[model samples]
Target: MGWLVGVVAVVALLGFYLTFTAKRVDRLHARAASAGRALDAQLVRRAATSAVLAEEHGEPDLYAAARGALDARVEDREAAENDLTRLLRKQELDSSEASDVAVIAASRRVALARQVHTDFVRDALAVRSRPLVRALRMTRRHGAPAYFDIDDPTLPSVTQVTSRATRD
Candidate 1:
């Protein structure tokens, strides 16, 4: 009777462990999805703000090109965004309201949001790739998660230093 009770206890403990792991994997996947959406929103904000700045302060050609790219379809969005970046790099625009503070803040938000999304994706991937999860087909229901990649400018070193100093 003692041996039988021990066996039953071990089985119950194993079952609980498996259930907990499965729930954790599901939570991670959900977190990754949420982060991805946030990143997408930030990206859109960056592009729209850039377009506005380009129109207000950039040359006419730059404004036209940027406006077109901002309105581009989803299939061509990546390339259009890359082109917008290149155009901005080629010109020195006047500091209108659009470019003075708004664009700078938008760019910074995009960089931070991208980093957050990437971290969440890594967490989900780590959980989904675990040996037990893989063997048990635990993540098969949700399919695979993907990482978002985009080219955006980093915040200036001066801005970074000032922010750190203020925090301290």
Candidate 2:
């Protein structure tokens, strides 16, 4: 009877240990997943801001460096997301530094993208319109001669032997 009771007590302790440890593991996994989701949302917002700057500038070269940086940030975000899932499965810290590096890279991208857009908007030729766009060949040709042919006989050629320079 004594031996049987000892065996039963050991089985009950093992059951409690498995139950508590599994719950702890699940809670840690959940925390990691939430952190990863937050990081993804932040990176997505940064990428969108970069896209807006690119569109506003019209010239990709104006923001190519910044855009490339943003792309690297996005790649990092995606890698972080993937690593979160992997960590959940493998329960390891081998890739946590990589995720940290990704966040740093994204922060740098945001700063650079902001600076490039600011400079571009300030120096942008398209942004300035000191003179309105005038149609060259349109009916309202301001600088062109009123007549169709400059040498038309009916209109009298100005460039004939009767040079305008001589007459003037």
Candidate 3:
């Protein structure tokens, strides 16, 4: 009987230990998934700035080119996330380690995307503030055509006509 009692106690202790460990594993897994989603959200938000904000600056060509590049980088980041998730699952990595790797990968892309967008914005702003823009605006306000050769395609048809008259 004593031997049986001892066996029962050991079994109960083992059950409790297993339950505790399983709960801990579950918590960690939840944290990893949540962290992955958070990182993805940050990446998405940063990716949008170049498209939405830059378009307002009257830079269609620059906006189109940058938007394309940003879209590609964002897709690459998403694929990286998917690959990391697959790696973690296949390797049966610890939940904490899986979350850490995902966070790091997302962060690297976020930093790069933000840096590129920031540089583009800075250049656009610098160009907006140049003397040429101000001078041209002043000329238009004074009812004088901007001081440019008529062959520039951006010039209006009426302005181009004036240029044609001068040449003829």
Candidate 1, residue 166: how far the Cα is off, in Å: 30
The CA lDDT of each predicted structure is 0.73, 0.38, 0.41
RMSD of model 3 against the true structure: 29.1
lDDT of 2 by residue, 1-168 (tens): 999999999999988766664454444434434444454454455444434544554536424433443455533534443332222222221223443234334444434443433343333222122232222212131221111111100111122256688898
Model 3: per-residue Cα lDDT over 1-168, one tens digit each: 999999999999988866664454444434444444554455554334433433444546434533444455633554433332333222221223433334334445555544444444444334435575455442232221111111111101111124666888
Candidate 3 displacement at residue 92 in angstroms: 44
Q: TM-score ranking from best to worst? A: 1, 3, 2
Model 1 clash count equals: 0
Q: Give the TM-score of candidate 1.
A: 0.77
Whole-structure CA lDDT of model 1: 0.73
**lDDT value for candidate 3?**
0.41
For residue 163, model 2's alpha carbon misses the true position, in angstroms, by: 63
Q: Please report the TM-score between candidate 3 and the true structure.
A: 0.37
How do the predictions measure up, each by TM-score? 0.77, 0.34, 0.37
| Number of backbone-clashing residue pairs for each candidate, in the order shown | 0, 0, 0
